[model samples]
Target chain A: MATPLLDKVEDEAAASPYITVTLRIRRFNPEISDEARWEDFSIEIDPKERVLDALHKIKWDVDGSLTFRRSCAHGICGSDAMRINGKNRLACKTLIKDITSFDRKTGATKPITVEAIKGLTVLKDLVVDMEPFFQAYRDVMPFLVTTGNEPTRERLQSAEDRERFDDTTKCILCAACTSSCPVFWNDGQYFGPAAIVNAHRFIFDSRDEAGEQRLEILNDKDGVWRCRTTFNCTDACPRGIEVTKAIQEVKRALITRRF
Target chain B: MSADTTATGSTAAISPVESVSVFDVDHPAPLIEPPRKRTAKTPKATRGNFEMAAWLFMRLSGVVLVVLVIGHLLIQLVLDGGVARIGFAFVAGRWASPWWQTWDLLMLWLAMLHGGNGMRTIINDYAERANTRLWLKGLLYTATVFTILLGTLVIFTFDPNIR
Candidate 1:
């Protein structure tokens, strides 16, 4: 009787197998050591679980010292962006099954290295200090600036005009697009993509009257001109925004001496 | 006996391999990626492969950029004279060397291409109208190719002592 039960359990386990993937996370503890080192965790997980889920498991069970920042548990928050398997991606959205399926030889998966967004100080395991990212956004004056009095009635906008700036308005203040940019990585002064995209949102707005001021602010060496349009920002944007398009439009606007 | 069974039977009978010609007429195949005949041959519609290449260029260039950029920072800011020493003389001396020239050239070329391709990708993905894409990319590529060629020419043929 026991033998039959064991056989049934084994058969069930074989049919729905759980995969073990190694997560080689970079560990830095100011209290422990001056330098950072890689720490590997072998965890069994369902194929559909995301890397963010794996990190949660590691933090919850495997090791308490592993530190990272995450919110909303979805791609919208953009808090969980990390270098997974050498590419920058949002941890919540990237399913482990998709990554492992690509590996033909070893259905086994390699450790998905998790690190903070580059070009910023890593506060801990996967959280980088985001002050610099936000500073650039602030410098761009992300809020809409209207020269005249506020609209007393509902501000009317044509459908086509509204659609023009629709995509840019989807930005959730997530710095994934900004941090992934190489130009921003090189020069801190560069306004970066997110800031420019925000400025675009206001600049292109029909009601906004501060386009010239914002354009002048963006005209500096560290402003819109620094964007080399690497598309890393686009790839890294979990929001599916066409960031470079907004930057190019700004450039064209500046060149033609238009808004 | 059943209609569904007969339909399944007919499909099975006509194997995909055997009925490719039959399938071609009814199914209107995915726009066959334009054949790559050298310049002599002009295929009907230029599939957006040029744009695709520009897309791939961004990724490849981005990877190379990581190295070029990191090395550049290490040399210019962290090493020797640091930020203060960088000036026209420093640039002139660096450009004097073939190795540095090649490095700078590669950096310039890769950075510009990466950036241009990135902007191209942006134009295709965002600029909805055909004419808009054309004008924007025309300006972008014109500026990019012009800057790249001019920069390359200046780099190799630069005479520092010109009065």
Candidate 2:
């Protein structure tokens, strides 16, 4: 047992030349701290490793108290979305090699900054209260709406009709795009990009009967007008959903009652 | 992981009449938005096309502004000795023509509106507080109106030969 442990240490040292990275994460402990503070932890990681992996190592090996949200580890769940290197992105999706900049003099690792998405209240380290995000999604009524369905068969639709709103259907409810929005950050009540993206999914659906109602809900002053076409949402979206274009299409649909 | 309200406290002690969300999955609360002063500021449903009109106007005016501004520069500066040869006589000569007068007038109005709207958007984005935003926008509109009125007066009342 003692021999294996010593050999394992040797194996790790002999492993591929790993890069040392400093993760400057914003920490907030509601119980202990009155204000949020930045904490740095240096870890040796492979060039291909993700920010999430570094967080896991810090939580598991370095400090068990380190906290963050992660699921599936593959960017599908949209749970690990945070500001990575000053831009909103999925922690699992962003790699350390791409974001890190090295100091030319000493070749030292420049710290990678990570913070919670803006606008929402942060519950603790890197975990925000997502209730407000979910509430905006709910306000848009994100499910397919139909009435008086007597046919037991699946609603038949042409391929062209399905392609109409196909782009918006790719949204995984990640608030990266929404939270990066300046308007949403300014006004808490604004519907934000996420809600508008979800609305576009159903408003363009051929079989949906309640398109008018959803359009009515989004036609208010806070609905589409608040969007300044800043392109922040489009840049922040890890899914490449073309969030700004979807918002424009929604705005056009409001003017001309046809989607 | 999602926010775990369970670890926050016991369920029995929570109040029943609370308006905000009590639970994530069950007994969800409706999103309480800030009360919009819709009556005075943003028009009602019947008049919601105001923003739509403004949006459409920007694109159309931008296309026109491009033509007007480029034509203007080409005649005054690019075609000749750029800015060195231009003088009061040059401006007086151009404004004397009804065609140039109308062109300048249209450009003035359109450019002011476009620039004013652009500034309003910037103010809205940068100004964090409500009162600050309102004050900034109010000043923007006032300056925009003043400039527009003054420029319109100059165009219409210009006498090429004051002597």
Q: Highest TM-score: which candidate?
A: 2
TM-score to true structure, per model: 0.58, 0.77
Error of 1 at B147 (Å): 19
Candidate 2 regions with alpha-carbon error over 4 angstroms: A1-20, A46-49, A95-108, A228-230, A255-259, B1-47, B78-93, B159-163
Per-residue accuracy of model 2 over A66-122 as CA lDDT, tens digit each: 678988889898999999888999999998889999999999989899998888877
- Tell me the tens digit of each residue's lDDT in model 2 across B37-95: 11235334443556666667778889999999999888877887887878889889888
Regions of candidate 1 where Cα sits further than 4 Å from its true position = A1-14, A101-107, B1-163
Error of 2 at A108 (Å): 4.5
lDDT of 1 by residue, B1-163 (tens): 0011111111121123332333333443232111121122422222222433443466678999899989999999989869889988888899889998998899999999888876765664455455887999999989999999999999989987865
Ten-residue region with minimum lDDT total, candidate 1 chain A? A28-37
Question: Chain A only: TM-score of every candidate?
Answer: 0.89, 0.92
> What is the per-residue lDDT of model 1 for residues A91-155, given as tens digits with 9 covering 90 to 100?
89988777653356855675567776776666656777777678778877887676567778977
Q: How much is A80 displaced in model 1, in angstroms?
A: 1.4
